[model samples]
Target: MEAAGEPIPLSALQHAVYCLRQAALIHLERLWAENVFTAEGAVLHAVADKGGGRHARGVRRVMSLPLASRRLNLAGVADVVEFPRVGGQETPFPIEYKRGKPKLHRADEVQLCAQGLCLEEMTGAPVPQGALFYAATKRRVVVPFDADLRALTEAAAADLARVLASGETPPPTPLKARCRACSLHDLCRPEAVARPARAWRDRMVAAEVGPR
Candidate 1:
């Protein structure tokens, strides 16, 4: 967890889970570039930002809802929040929009959980669950605000705080598929930077030890 009054963007947690260097580049270094994937995501967010509220049946739908959590020191916007009025009671839940499919990492889930945390703070109500709307799948993946996922989300926030406190970009951890998919690949240039640095560090170590 971050020290008091040191809030970071909730999106930074998603970036950190995807790649520490990527998170540092965006949040710490404040650099960004748009690629095909990012552009598509921007387009999706544009639609989400239409800022209209409506009700269907017993459910109230809100778009582009701002959220913040002082406990977690994170803030961001939800794509949609659904308040289902069931049996004269209402349960408010978040739904995030993603342009792509789910990945092996906890990036998307952490983001949604962070929103739930924010909602709980703002509404003073318990948020037991949320959903992720994947454009490719055209489905909602329900995510329970369980202890494990909450811990992961909090840990991600702390990880981001550490990165920001250091004020240094993290070294690139280049995996072929991950780097290839990352929109910031051109800016980060892991292959051009980190691999060569590793080689130089290896050479320095070898020189110091001498041949046995």
Candidate 2:
């Protein structure tokens, strides 16, 4: 749980889940770059953000809603939260907007789960499930608020808080897959770190053998 006056951003959880280095760059350094994918995502979020107020079809759709979860130490603006009528009362359901289709990554889920935790804290209600709206597929994927997801969300949040408080940017993992799409590729220069580490090792080995 987060202390009073300390707010955790939902994006932090996603960053921690995806890559610690990315999270550090975004939160610690306040560095950002908009790529093609991110730009499209911004457009989608804008549409949702503009569609304000609650709807009439037993669905109260709130866009860009601010949320915070002290227990998870997470906070952020939810893209949209649909309150469905249940037993004559509206139940909260968080829906997140994504630029791409679902992948083999838990990053999206961690993000949504953090949002759910925030909504639960803010509304004093139990959010059992949420939805992910993907722009590429133009479809909604339902996410169950299971024990595993909740645990992951909380753990990620705690980890993010620790990282942010430390005020240190973590080194990149330099996976080819991450490098290809990461907006911080040029700035991070993962190859540089890897090459230097390898070179240093080589130099140490050479020095050890030369004086014999």
Tens-digit per-residue lDDT, 65-180, candidate 2: 88887666556788899999788877789899899899688889989988887887788878899999998899999999899998987787777777777777766677898777
Supply the global lDDT for candidate 1: 0.86
Which residue pairs does candidate 2 place in steric collision? Answer: 8-75
Which 10 residues in a row give candidate 2 its minimum summed lDDT? Answer: 1-10
RMSD of each: 2.8, 3.9
Local lDDT at 64 for model 2: 85
lDDT of 1 by residue, 1-212 (tens): 23346778777788888888898888777788888888888888897799788997758999988888888778777889999865587778999999888778888999989999999899887899999988889888999999999998889888888778878787887899989998898889999898788998899999999987
Q: What is the lDDT of residue 179 in candidate 2?
A: 75
Question: How many angstroms is residue 199 displaced in model 1 relative to the true structure, after the best TM-score fit?
Answer: 3.7
